[model samples]
Target: MEVTTNTQVNERELWGGGAKPFSASYGKIMMWFFIVSDALTFTGFLVSYGFSRFKNINSWPIADEVFTHFPFLHGIDAPMYYVALMTFILIFSSVTMVLAVDAGHHMNKSKVTFYMLLTIIGGAIFVGSQAWEWKNFIKGEYGALETKGGQILQFVNLENDKRISIQDFAIGINSERKTHKSNIGLWYQNEKTLPKITVEEVKKGFLANPNLTIRTEQISENGQKTLLSRDEAIYKIDDATGVVEGANLIHNEYGNRLFADFFFFITGFHGFHVFSGVVINIIIFFNVILGTYEKRGHYEMVEKVGLYWHFVDLVWVFVFTFFYLV
Candidate 1:
């Protein structure tokens, strides 16, 4: 009877005996532990993000302004739309992964395969969308000016608060400027090169051309350097633009070098993570097509990669919040 009781207890425990049952395998448990550790690591990243926010409390950029582009809604000021779409795509992939796991439990290889494929396709789409977003970010919509002091000053076309670029400010009939020759010493021929229009000249033309004006020094500097304030705007000639001067960092408009350094470092790190996630997803996707996991009777590999994908998404959430939104 004791032996019978022991056997029954073991069977029950192995199947569904208690809350603290030790029936799960070492591999699955380790995966859960690893996920926990990874969660902590992400938390660390977010905490650091918070620290930076605190440090730059006054100068942080607005996420909404920075990421206002939609997939097709050109000229519309809809912010967070694409990011929301990407978030949904990731969540949907997670659902498909869970469905794949269910199919695996039922021993339905075909259904599991289909769901896995869908998950991969969704991930590919998300990565593609991310690439698009990155392209826009790198190209920048409204370029800013960098100061000699490494500070960014953005120009607003006085009539509109929307940011303007050096190209935008260019006005009528200035003779095309000659490029500075690198080997001026070797080529002594005073080739009658057309005189280049000075930034000062460009500024004067811009002032004369009612379409442009100087952005107030007090108007810009909220991290983004994208927005301009017409209220504080001055009609006075800018020393730099003479035509119209505003401060900004794009095109080294801000003289501050640290702005460029920080911009590249932070964005580059995030972009690298996105690139790595794409490569990893591609590997898992091919594995799904090859039916490798079906033979193994489990698609836990998908689950692992899914965790990583979710992590990248989560990090972007914070980055968007801090860098763009906040």
Candidate 2:
């Protein structure tokens, strides 16, 4: 009788030599390592943001109110529409990347090239959309007043239940005050560009517009900003110390300064990643056209980048949910 001896190899012990541990190539494994590390970094940022937001829940800005602008639809309330569109485009780009990688697997160079170009175009559109959103965020539409307590006060129309721009009602009081020039004043410090309307001007305007009421950043139990009575509004206007027209590291017209801070840091970091992925996709795109990967007899590079692109898309889902939806 001839008996066949079965060899049962220990998988972990066999892969302990640090080569293709999980049936993945060196480049693919390295890409996964990078993705895991990056995921942890993003997790930390979102957690910090979560804590900060919870600590100031009542004072936090409403996502719907703050992000209301849409491209070429001025004065129309399209709350979260543009942001939703951006998310959709990013997700679609991920789909294109998957197609590109699949095509590369079959050595279909033409199909790979087509899908990659689509992926790049989608990425570029998302990047451009983000810049537009940032522009609207930095250059606020309706201006606000900052109180001595470092909180902001917005103006909303009692008649229409909508926000009103400071410029629409602010009567420009003649000011003898001029922006300080270092040469004419203290030789060391030059004043930054002054706000178009002063706090005093906003106060004067508030007093004149009986239909306009003051809205504080503090959210009521009903989840709306605590609107002040006419008397309270008048009293609150007196606490105004400076004019706030937009968001910055220092102040935010929307609400708590921390919101803007986290928004810039987290979103900016993710934006950098998207921009980098686009650049990489473009490079691979050109190489596919030039038959470089075809000569190498494999398209592992495309698969590697596809992993990163998918990771980026997944990260944005969390970001959009926690930061915007929540």
Candidate 3:
């Protein structure tokens, strides 16, 4: 009589046993399935994003102006630097995850724990930095004027090519005692309103300042922005110092509503993923502390999470290319 032993039962048979529960290597299989599904989800999002980007053919905010913020420099014209740093942080975390898995192979608990800690730290820093980036983006810079056709027009100092802001043209006015004040008792107390400055004020300032020139947001790849000569710029406006009406999102001072929407959705989604990735890393970090994988004799958990970390990095590469470099 032939008897079946555990070793004799092939992996396929074990997993596909008649009316049997799946007996495959749980970690690796789950990791692969998760990755496949996640890939499809990301693909859907990116494709939809692409469709919107393509549909909005004429006017898009230049990614450079939209994301230009640098650390310690306050409000300098540094675009893509912070995100580049975040990208490196995620990539570095992936390396640490791999190192953690390698250490787990030799049952070196200390090394595994150390690398895992570093990985968690990297993920956290990336999320925080991303938050700052998003904050700056939503607030906007050099607040634009949107035309009826949905084009953005921006201000620039012609002599130096430095962009101008509404703040530069702002002449602070003294508020009356009857002026509306923010509610203090609300859960989110009153925030100070941004002082209003008119487009006319800006144009008048520009006229006075000969170095100033106006550039429309419709720029080509060659760095040529459709610009307005001083006469043309001042000519279009009935009131140079009066504020251009409407929010910057719909008919931005730059021109396209789609640009702001895409900026919010695409980068917002990517930032959300980064936030969730950090949360997952934190959970894995605690698992490492508890020696959960050590008991299993495999650090496949770390490897699985590592794959996710790398995937985030990979997505960012495409985003950077399309949004900035391209």
**Number of the predicted model whose lDDT against the real structure is largest:** 2
lDDT of 3 at 46: 70
For each candidate, C-alpha RMSD in Å? 7.3, 4.7, 5.2
Each model's TM-score, in the order given? 0.67, 0.93, 0.77
Clashing pairs in 2: none
- Judged by TM-score relative to the true structure, which candidate is superior, 2 or 3? 2
Best by TM-score: 2
Please identify model 2 stretches exceeding 4 Å from their true place. Answer: 1-19
The global C-alpha lDDT for each of the candidates, from Candidate 1 onward, is 0.58, 0.89, 0.67
* Candidate 1, 70-139: lDDT as tens digits: 8779989888888778778866876786786677677677777788677767767876876786666655
lDDT of 3 at 224: 66
lDDT of 2 by residue, 1-326 (tens): 12322222223223447544677666788899999999999999999999999999888988888788999999898888998999999999999999999999999999999999999999999989988988999988788989999999999999998888999989889998888888887476788889988887888888998999899998999988899998899888999999998899998999899999999998899999999999999999999999999998788899999999999999999988977788
Q: Which stretches of candidate 3 lie over 4 Å from their true place?
A: 1-24, 56-58, 170-195, 199-211, 238-255
